[model samples]
Target: MRIYFLSRRKLILLLMFLITIGGLLTINLLTQTIPSLVRTPGTYYMAKTQEKVVALTFDDGPDPVDTPDILNILKEKDVRATFFVLGKAAESNPALLKRLVKEGHEIGNHGFTHDYQQRKLVAEMNQTDQVVFNSTGNHTYFYRPPGGLVSKTQMEATKRNGHVVALWSVDSKDWRNPGVKQIIDNVMKNVFPGAIILMHDGGYQRTQTVKSLEPILNALKASGYRFVTLSELRTLDSDLK
Candidate 1:
């Protein structure tokens, strides 16, 4: 009798396992039919299509004072870059948003309020995207966390909205009020093929960033590096697809 009971338990457990697997497969198939209303799972900000090209991602932007200067340098250099503009600032300064679009720069959401206390606030993400996307749809489905703060939950939220979560490998510390030369040094030291460089255009004390942009861009350009926007750069490989 004891042996028979154990055999029954094993068969029951196997049956339950098969049921769960079948349910998961059904759910996954249903999701594909529902269309992608969420983000894909990947942390890419540069194209893997080449070896020497680097993508530049500037966050916290639409600053009426400093951003224009950065745009000018980009135009003069004839290079394309990505700007993750905060939704609140973009809403307030429509002209700045227009400039970015008109100048062929890719704009992405950086949260509406620029608060970084939470890893990934779904409420904040929804609110920011509603304001930025429904209003203009100028932004691509690309976003960065406020201050690089991220968690598994937050990252999942980023995907649900059909956006990619961009994290930087090279930070210039421009947010900490570093001088131009030091910021330049930081980029030069950390740069490599397929590197994503982080700088700010709209956050507090971004003037120092403006000063650093010209020299850094010139140096990188001189070094056989080509600048591409984060979206363009994200085609790193077919693996992401």
Candidate 2:
């Protein structure tokens, strides 16, 4: 029989090295898996299309202050985007919701309140859907959760409520008040064919987002990209057909 023994100091050093390697591996696995795990199934991040089509989606909106400015900019630029509005906000601003529909913009469900219990998420979604339908006579088939945090169970509930999860490929991070230049830069950096850009029209002062809007549109237009609503962007996807 052959026996090998390490000194106590060497054993401690080896144990520390092993612990460091295990920790790194654990972090790497989590980084790779958590994003995929959090994303709901049947979610549309970007379309699979050859056309230079992009969808600009705003969340937590229909604000009397910022939403009007956003709609005005879209109207002026002759561009149409999707607004995912909360039910409470939609109820308070039916005219804005009506204007969104009347102006040829798309409306989506962003839940009743910003947050809800997991079991009640579907009810919240349905409530928003009802509000949208009542306000605009248009049923909202798309939904985005607050803070983009969704679980499998919540997604299943959303599916039961007949809503497709709408995630984003190009996140502007504009909700953080990241400044107009950074917002534009974030969108420009991730802009691509069939990209869905995330911005916000409600939930805090969206002055920076409002300011960043036109320049982003102009730059993308210069790059030969055409803007489309989320539904239209879905139609561009051959996979969906």
Candidate 3:
């Protein structure tokens, strides 16, 4: 077998390539970790409280069927939740938006569409806010970005629009059409006091979500967990401070 060696120039190029890859990896790591380290103002993932309370937030809704089902469950359980709705959906189902407010549930802007393009973030937020205001006769102060995604510019725009970014801590992953048991387990395993539990009322078939709701509510209520809206959860956090 003949042995081959890289030339000095080729060796230098290989070293440079490795260094470039390392730098990119470092940047990716920092991008993932730094947000957890530095908290953005007016943005909340979970409230800072130990009151055995959690906020139930539903996104991508005002769905004609699923929203009503979820609402019925919440009404039956005597629990209030926050619904982050898309403008297009709300426009189509204005009555659902009105019903949400009438039932003591909070409304939050989830943008105009499910698209999460950064450049249209503010525009989408504004459009959704307008739709909500038109339907509910009340302005929304909370904005949960579509898919829980945010950027510096998006955060800045959200602040400028006077909306607090509402994010969730416990994700049920029901969007994946995970089985009812798995959805319940996903939440039960991760839930904590002041957790903002993420579930979806729309954007796909949510039968599992609706089916999982009563059991999850029963389990949490039995554990002495009270469900509150995102606004109430924020108020609790403020009271702690």
Candidate 4:
């Protein structure tokens, strides 16, 4: 009886060891494939584009004061960007949301309460358009995760909803109020073709964000890059195909 019990314990230990190894290997494989499958093709990086264009995505907003200012800047600069507005925030800023659509910028889902995980974010994104559209009822296709975190469930949900998970290639850390000059410098150094740049229009320390927009737009334009909304960039990609 003692031998039998000892043998059973050994067998259980071996099984646990195998399971741990298996789980690690599975995670490794998934981690390897994430970059390609998630963002860039085959590498999970930014989308490839021949055109000298970039996607500007803003999050955590629809701020009553700041969003309108950002929109005005876009209009004056002859540029449009993607606004990843939160779902709860969206309700309060119905007029601002409508204005985003009216002025020809892309309105992507940033999640209902600004959930950080990609899955919950995607789930929030799925119907944000419907709720917004039913208020006015037009089809819009854009989804960005809050704080740029994504998961398998989020990807699947986004794909099912016919939206791509938009991820950024450049971050100016503008949300940190890292000085307007520093913010400007970061972009000047980091900007790339088909780059998706992240910025926030409404969250705290956004004065720096508002400050950074103009010079970045002007400099990029002078450098021969065209500024376009999130939806327009997607259409450009589809047309390229």
If scored against the real structure, what TM-score would every candidate get?
0.76, 0.83, 0.83, 0.76
Off by over 4 Å in 3: 1-42, 238-240
| Winner by lDDT | 2
Tens-place lDDT per residue, model 1, 1-241, is 3554447889999899999999999998754432112222455544455568788878887888898899999999998888887878777777877778778888877887877755446666676677666546754577777766666787777788777788776778777675888999989998888878888888786888989898999999899988877766766544455
Question: For all the candidates, what are their Cα RMSDs to the real structure?
Answer: 12.0, 4.5, 4.8, 7.7
Q: Residue-pair clashes per candidate, as listed? A: 9, 0, 0, 8
Supply candidate 2's per-residue lDDT for 81: 95
lDDT (0-100) at residue 4 of candidate 3? 89
TM-score of model 1 vs. true structure: 0.76
Residue by residue across 1-241, what tens digits does model 4's lDDT show?
Answer: 3544458889899999999999999999765543223343311225467888988878888899889888999989878888887777777788988888888888877777766544455456756776677644665566766666566666676778787667777777786676999988888798888777878887565888888899999999998898777666666674345
Full-model lDDT, candidate 2: 0.87
Give the distance in Å from residue 91's predicted Cα in candidate 3 to where it truly belongs: 0.1
Error of 3 at 94 (Å): 0.8
The TM-score-based order of candidates, best leading, equals 2, 3, 1, 4
When 1 and 2 are scored with TM-score, the better candidate is: 2
- Candidate 1, which segments miss by more than 4 Å at Cα? 1-42, 45-50, 236-238
Error of 2 at 184 (Å): 0.4
User: How high is the CA lDDT of each candidate model?
Assistant: 0.76, 0.87, 0.86, 0.74
Candidate scoring better on TM-score of 1 and 3:
3
